[model samples]
Target: INIIIQNQTMIAQMPHAADLNDVMSAIEAMRIQEESSYQCPDYLSKSEEDGSALPVNEECRRKMAEWCYQVVDYCKFSRETVAIAMSLIDRYLASNQGREALANRKLFQLAAMTSLYSAVKVHEPEAMEPKTIAGLSRGAYNEDQVTAMELEVLGAIGWRMNPPTPLAFVHHCLALLPDGSMSMSDREAILEIAKFQTELAVHDYSFVHIDASKIALAAV
Candidate 1:
């Protein structure tokens, strides 16, 4: 928990009216935007073992997601980056289903890496370049290929990079709790638990379509 908590010095801050208002506004916006653009493809429509129609089936999706998590973990980026990257991949795939351009495994890998690169660029303070991502690909992809795929993914998703992730909802919901309702340490403990659940949820394709707010509340 401490490792990921960022600031270990817990300065207990009380929730104010403006703070609550901002959260409420953000939550409402997230709910609206979620339905409008962020909803992922249905897990119920999972392809068969052979991945007949789509090369990027649920198994492939989970593997990519897990790989994203590994990259963020190794790079010490927020675990939420994995959630955001996965969301980008999902929303792009949802927009273009079974398209021949994305029907190849090699192309799928490019899309996955480019999604992670784009997410990091948008959300992380230290942005990762296409070449860095290419190096991580271990010669499977080159910088130019990654650069091209980044543009394709960005355009596919309408450049809406910041989707409300489960972790974001978790933090916002936790803020809504009455101040001093519990010891800061206890609150941190609960957060640690919920964070673990959300991270696991990100890896499982089953939860991709489920609303992030619902998943966050359930995890809490």
Candidate 2:
């Protein structure tokens, strides 16, 4: 299912992936990824099974990511939005000051919702609004709260919004293989499997700090 199925108008249009790929050189793509790769969240210092080191446990974080997935699926927003949102959440929570904030579950959920809101607002602006995101919280939060959290989260991440994604890395790596190396049918099958690994990495918290390039390489 395509995450974005917009009704285009004369004012603007979504460029096809092919249209975009044609303009960008692979060297430039890798360079951009190199610049942005440091923006990824730190390896979670604590785990659920371990004696507590941080208030934000891994399971809770995992659940938050899943909820984001559910919301994006319902809204027909790109599933990649969840990855982006979770990246924001993780980067924020991994901070010294933010460590205390994660101790509060309500604040965490509000932050979670806000992160999702921020992602959709950035990537799928027409799909949702802060008011709608607040409503989805079942009255636990209001529009003001969501908006504030969005600002706070963005501030926490130093306004570096374009985090590298595993899928993007996968695409670049796949393109490196010569077309003659594999039959079209076999190439398609391999691509599907490789893409699936990237999806799994996106959902699994252990993969958070791993480089997107590393994940992509492992996937293939």
Candidate 3:
């Protein structure tokens, strides 16, 4: 009994690894589609409680966020890329009944990866040439891993790539906001905020189940 107590204490004192149940619950909360319209607030609360961990360490979060912004800025990707990716993942899962070819894994990563793959295909076709896509997920696992899974994703969802993105909306809204109203830096800041909203949408099934045309509007 004493030894067991010590072991439990040590485990608890160690860094908090992600709680699997909590993550799944959060994932469930983010799921947008339901046969029923009603949802349990308790379920969402529980997931939120579990998913409270910082996505990265404090110092790293800012750095990572900045890096992501730079990439977006450099690439000149419209916010639509993020929205399109989100919708693609949601559509793929609903179409497949949330089943990927590979079983026994979190649907979240698979969805994120697939959405990203689809976005790359449409938005950055030249940069995301077959070779590049293959390289991104290579060696980490069998090239066949993401490949087979991606194929399954494609099969589950028909080729419907032309989704409106938040960037499109941002442009539209900004244009109508009044010319010369905001500085370039201010415009980028607004865009950044929209991007964050897009990411939050990606986390839940809301992106998947919502209309693509409305995705940008909702996200922004």
Candidate 4:
């Protein structure tokens, strides 16, 4: 209850257009300046090279990603949450090399749920309970398992959950658009379309190797 109230308060206090413009401008500038440094290696392609050992193939990844999207939608979480969860899953798999434990179907499901749970905690003030997350997994994972995997994933990623997602870059680029290029309504319409495209990009395995900023621009 308190957490929900806090979230609502935060939303209510969001900055107006003028302040948002300034913040987005700064983000856009920083993104451009550090674009080269932000290149995440082709983790998906590398994972495929060791596919015989990893067990989780492209089809498995696609199913889990779809499940994550469904869970996020059912829970009314933002698309950003799903994107972050996908990012963590990819990074964890890539960083751990041939950890055969992830090959287990049950363990893989738990990892997916845990990644979503972690993203929720970071991106939502009022997070779903561990039991709720486990329930959504259709009993493949219990609350305790979900809790444990959450810690494991956090450690695996070295607690770096703040990767720059395509959505972030999209907003930054949208802010950088010329002021007189379009009316406010037109700009909002473009943002809506871009965001929808970004959501599609998030689940597609083909886009996994692409840079986030490039994906953002492409979506726009």
Q: How far is candidate 3 from the true structure (C-alpha RMSD, Å)?
A: 18.2
Per-candidate TM vs. native?
A: 0.85, 0.78, 0.49, 0.81
| lDDT per residue as tens, model 2, 133-191 | 77899999987888788788888888765666666666666666655778878766876
Candidate that scores best on TM-score: 1
Better of 2 and 3 by lDDT: 2
Model 2: how large is the Cα RMSD against the reference? 5.7
Segments of candidate 2 deviating more than 4 angstroms: 1-37, 41-43, 46-53, 125-127
Backbone clashes in candidate 3 total 4
lDDT of 2: 0.68
lDDT of each: 0.77, 0.68, 0.43, 0.69
| Winning model by lDDT | 1
Where's the lowest-lDDT run of ten residues in candidate 4? 4-13
Per-residue lDDT over 133-198 for candidate 1, one digit per residue giving the tens place of the 0 to 100 score: 889989999888988788888888888987888877777788888778899899889889998999
Model 3 lDDT at residue 207: 37
Better model by lDDT: candidate 2 vs candidate 4: 4
TM-score head-to-head 1 vs 4, winner: 1
lDDT of 1: 0.77
Candidate ranking (lDDT, best to worst): 1, 4, 2, 3
